[model samples]
Target: MKFDTTQLSQKTQTLSPYSRLPTPCSLLPLLKLYNKTISQIVKLWNH
Candidate 1:
């Protein structure tokens, strides 16, 4: 239920260096897109 920034940053360090981009932004819409895409993919697979 609670989000942890330290854990997330540590996880992302394994993937890339931090200086390449801006910091985090509003993610509500990004999560919506992710949910939509997942459902769409599931529907495609079922069809």
Candidate 2:
């Protein structure tokens, strides 16, 4: 199986609470996404 990380960037992501938005709302989402991605990669390598 092949993984293309560049593809992830190609997908458009909303600025998501950039202006006039709660701070945690913006940060938490990103932290979650990063954790999930890291877990997935770890699983793949472990297998």
Candidate 3:
């Protein structure tokens, strides 16, 4: 089977989260905050 580079590049662009977001670095802080919130909620639920 022959591989198409153009098709592969397009697929990569579509699949990449960095391409969809305006700032890739922004996701890290938001993810950390979300995790902290989730853990705090779980702790409260457990108590």
Candidate 4:
């Protein structure tokens, strides 16, 4: 089975709480963590 990661990007956009945008460098770590959490959830669902 193939995992669609594009959905992850869409989900991340909605899940983010910031009204005003921060610099990309600052957001990188938070985005990484969010993506990691999403990946873990997907793994759990696959099992």
Candidate 5:
């Protein structure tokens, strides 16, 4: 379950140079929204 930087870099290298990846800035909102949804789900299960 460890995060593997080498594996990530290898995958990225296989992509076309013109392909775009989401920057951290773009990912932040998605991460926040995902967290909020998980929190709500936990609350419902706890209820």
Candidate 6:
């Protein structure tokens, strides 16, 4: 599993231009919330 820049660029070509922009710091809270929800779902399923 290796990807060259050309391959990645080709793949991203179909996506919106904004998709190549750097991730914003505001996403950290959303990612934390998503992880917490997934952990809670896993805990419920384990029981």
State residue 41's C-alpha deviation in candidate 4, in Å. 0.3
Worst 10 residues of 4 by lDDT: 12-21
Taking every candidate in turn, the Cα RMSD to the unseen true structure, in Å, is: 13.5, 18.4, 6.3, 19.2, 12.6, 11.0
Estimate, for each residue in 1-47, the C-alpha lDDT of model 3 and write its tens digit. 89999999999999999767767587789989999999999999999
Candidate 2, 1-47: lDDT as tens digits: 79877766554234334444668877899999999999999999999
Q: State the lDDT of candidate 6 residue by residue for 1-47, as single tens digits.
A: 77599978877785867766658687888899999999999999999
The top-ranked prediction according to lDDT is 3
lDDT at 27 for candidate 1? 62
- lDDT value for candidate 6? 0.85
Give the Å shift of residue 13 in candidate 5.
11
lDDT of 1 by residue, 1-47 (tens): 89999999877886676555554565677888999999999999999
Select the stronger candidate by TM-score from 3 and 6: 3
Ranking by lDDT: 3, 5, 4, 6, 1, 2
Candidate 4 residues lying further than 4 Å off, grouped into runs, are: 1-20
lDDT of 5: 0.89
Cand. 4 Cα-lDDT? 0.89
* Model 2 TM-score relative to the real fold: 0.48
User: Alpha-carbon error at 19 in model 3, in Å?
Assistant: 6.7
- lDDT (C-alpha, whole model) for all candidates: 0.82, 0.76, 0.91, 0.89, 0.89, 0.85
Name the regions of candidate 1 deviating beyond 4 angstroms.
1-25
Higher-scoring candidate on lDDT, 1 or 4: 4
